[model samples]
Target: MNAPVDIAKMLQPRPVPAAMLDALKARFGERCSTAQAVREQHGRDESPFEVPPPEAVVFAESTTDVADAVKLASQYEVPVIAYGTGSSLEGHLLAVQGGISIDVSRMNQVLRINDEDLTVTVQPGVTRNQLNNAIRHTGLFFPIDPGADASIGGMAATRASGTNAVRYGTMRENVLALEVVTASGEVLRTGTRAKKSSAGYDLTRLMVGSEGTLGILTEVTVKLYPQPESVSAAICHFPSIDAAVKTTIAIIQLGVPIARCELLDANAVRYVNNHDKLSLRPAPMLLMEFHGSAAGVAEQAQTVQEVARDHGGEDFQWATTPEERTRLWTARHRAYFAGMSSNPGCRTVTTDTCVPISRLASCIDKAVTEADEAGLPYYIVGHVGDGNFHIAYMIDPGKPEQRVLAEQLNDQLVHHALSLEGTCTGEHGIGLHKQGFLVDEAGAATVEMMRLLKRALDPKNILNPGKIFAL
Candidate 1:
């Protein structure tokens, strides 16, 4: 392990500016809260990191409200952190530098849906499930599914992708435009509904994964897809992780156009079974889905089944009905919560890494071996179709040593992925947890260029201050 670095100082909370508080309260009235409960709730995220809460919370109902809050914060030079449903795995919403949290949950609205053009414009607070439900009757669906019913704005900010990302791509591809409020409280529109554009700078792509540091997204426009006429989902068990990964590689290499291919280690299966109360085989497993016409779906499934059998996979458990498919996916999406329930009151420190498709088997094998040797309580799951996976280290938060061990394990795994030409983060962005890894992955020069852009765009550093990189 590398030498321990002192990060406590960096996590220290800054004092709330009195003038900023008064100004916000005056402008937002009851919508602005400094109450203890509200502040506590806004301070941290779903991650295991404990942090000081924001000094205040502003429930923004429109773009104007967000702009007003940011303008007030900029005047005081106080940090402005954007908050959604608080589902982020990293410490993206932590008030490390105390400031105001602009909660956009009230901004949930489906502004527009261009069915013919296959695009939908929504307020930042709109959840992915909500967007899909609103468009379900139109025979169109938003393909990105990051498990948690996370806000679309949050997903875009993190550039999240999921099981379907192998085919539909991540937020980077789906998001077509954004209406963002800059640090200075000015609104900037990026991109358009047009499918492709080589126009000027790709600002939409830049803001999609900026993690709210560059600007606060008030609106997002994303691509939608026509629902497949026939859908099939299945779960197949593998003799070993190696076999499971190899099957996934073969399927991807063969270009199967599989919609979803998720992997769960034996440990993960056991925990989910105990927590979700379903009897799944205690082995490396793959939860797959096929989206196409009936004949095409059948052909794709048969091909994947053959590939899996070649890798020593067992008979598949099929979910042919929509209800059955939903149940199976619900169990998969709740894997993190099930992992948390493994040890009541235990917190999880998670790490994700994505390597080239060919190197995934070797990368995961090393991680599993090292983690088992450490004997730390954990769960492993992956979007293996795209070579991205996560390990959740279940640690008793009261034990400082356990947290230390978990961080060490995560660091080792990230460095291992980097050695294999992989990225430190796949879908999850560089929040507080992966700041160090960002430098290692992107190199000093590239990070400096990013810093220059951040400074040029947000001169006061009030937009999510102390994130992505230090000023």
Candidate 2:
């Protein structure tokens, strides 16, 4: 069932002018790599979609490099795709249109830490864990954890949110400012160190989740949180999905201020236990964390426990020690890889949706039922506290039927969530996978407006062409 790939046809066979490549090589010297290995490496990501590699890969070390490369690309009308760590689940880094990829991984630097301002300015190549480690001594930590050690630039590009988003918010809320290299090769600084401002335009936000479609992010300044005095994590098993959903609803409605509240369906939990070698029960489970003063965390845990009990939750295990908490969350973060392990030699279509908190139960219940009836091997893990859940469908990529079915199931889930006033994508940006759904989620008029904005900024469409939406 392995399908033939028409890479050239898919890429539409766009030719990169040789003069531009020579100029880039001359300007960047050894940093400009036209090697096949480098092109292949920068062309694809964790996404399942396959595409031809870019014509060339430019390793950019600073904002000046990015601007220079972009300026040259603009001269040749060549598409420019920015590359970070390439951990993005969507095909955000793919050179689908046959262009050049500007890699910023070498730009890893912690530019500044204004501890008094509760903010840190960092290069785009800095990963979330890296930032936290760099600032750990400051007693302040960046809270956006998207499971993978994704670069800050990529995280901001995708507007990623993870377990902690329910409390501290996503890149949208945490990011304070940005240094962006526009399509015209001009550097624009958006936002300010000041917390609140009545600026002319919220350009920083406009670029935060632009997915490299609008411009390239060189530096990002993000708000950081003071380490909580007390932090506690808990695991609870539920008799059924109904009980788990109800407990989540009640917890959120009660305003528990839980730092992290994640749901692992029975199947997902079983896979996690197998992968992590833990002795957890094989049932739908909720992993939660509370951060506050010792007394406050204790009170929050007690309230959640009471709510869980009222909703038929059992096996309430609390992990207060650092070691225990790390072990617990490590298992949780490994859920994606663990689930993939359950089905060897299969590709995963990891999709997510966010709904109104009140409708979380209905949306998840319907999705689970349909997936069960479809008999697809899948796992469901969610940041249910924020009404965002992920369904990763393990599909035999060689089989077209499995891929089609997985997409159909995803479409159903997305349409259902949209019907319930939810978004097609919660955290993962609209890369190649979710392009069609973008217009569906946002009306034709809205998407057209977005296109207008894109045309205005990247008039030549040389910036990550054929992403978000098509002209």
Candidate 3:
């Protein structure tokens, strides 16, 4: 087990002066809240850190509202954290340093849709499902899905990618432009509607995965795709997890262009079956989707089926109808909740490590072995087509030893991944949880450069202080 750092000592909240609170309340009237319930809601996220709530919450309804609140905080030299739907898993929304949370949930709006250019502009609070529904009539859809009905701004902040990312790419590739509120509350625009640019630094890309440390995203313009002419979904059972992973690597190696390739171990399948009230074989399985022309979809499916069969896949089934496909995916999307349902009142220490395609099998195998040896309740799921997987260890919140064991397992897994030239996190950003691993993965000099950049942009260190790296 790695030596544990003193997390409590690292998170010291700055004073939120009464004058700052008064200024915020005066500027926004009833929109600024100091209610304990609201502050508590804005202070925490899906992470398991125990920190003091922010002094207040500001529900921003527009870009101007966000700018004004940020400007006030900047004047007071207090920390500011941005909040969306609160779906982030890496503690991105936690009020580690006391200040205010700029809740952008009220800014949900699809400002413009350029169907001719296959682009859509939206406010920060617009969700993936909401965006797709808003543009459904135009036969266009946003393909980046992080599986939490996550807000676009939050997704951009984390540079999230999910099932469709294997073919369509992540927020880093899809986001074309951003309207950001800098630390001084200055609204800056980056990128243009044109497909490519070489005029200056790619500031849009910089803010996409900065995790609210650099700035707050107010508006986003993202690329969209035309609805496929033919779409097909399927499920194939494998004899073991290794066989399932092998099949996925083969599919990707062959350049099959599979839209979604997800893996579920027997534990995950059982949880989803009991929770979703559906009967599925309690075995390792691959849930896949292919999108293209009718003939192209057929060819892709056939190629995948052959690869799976060669690796001992069985019970090949297809969901041709829209309803059937929805049922399966909805269940998959709810797998995290299902896992929680099986172990009520349990806190999970989830690991997200992505490796090179050729190294994925060894990485996952070592993880499964380590987890089994630890004797903790756990489950496995992954976007295997892109070489990313999650192994969530469910531990009792009241038992300190259990958490220690889980963290030890996580540490071992992350080091193993780093040894294989993989990242500490695949989709989830480094908020409060993986700061130590970031140093190990990127080394001290690289992380120092990041700190320098943060200090340079936010001299006051008021924008999301104590995140990504220490100031």
C-alpha lDDT score of every prediction, in listed order? 0.91, 0.91, 0.92
If scored against the real structure, what TM-score would every candidate get?
Answer: 0.98, 0.97, 0.99
Model 1 residue 178 distance off true place after TM-score fit, in angstroms: 0.6
The deviation in Å at residue 204 for candidate 1 is 0.7
> If ranked by lDDT, best first, what sequence of candidates would result?
3, 1, 2
Instruction: Give the alpha carbon lDDT tens digit for every residue of 283-361 in model 1.
Output: 9999999999999999999999999999999969899998999988998998999988888999988889999999999
Residue-level lDDT for 372 in candidate 2: 95
What digit string (tens of lDDT, one per residue) describes model 3 on residues 217-335? 99999999999999999999999999999999999999999999999999999999999998999999999999999999999999999999999999999999999999999999898
Model 2 stretches astray by more than 4 angstroms: 1-10
Instruction: Count the clashes in each prediction.
Output: 0, 0, 0
Query: Whose lDDT is greatest here?
Result: 3
For residues 244-319, what per-residue lDDT tens digits would candidate 2 score against the true structure?
A: 9899999999999999999999999889889999989999999999999999999999999999999999999999
Deviation in Å, model 3, residue 134 alpha carbon:
0.3
Name the 10 consecutive residues with the lowest summed lDDT in model 2. 1-10
Error of 2 at 181 (Å): 0.4
The Cα error of candidate 2 at residue 461, in Å, is 0.5
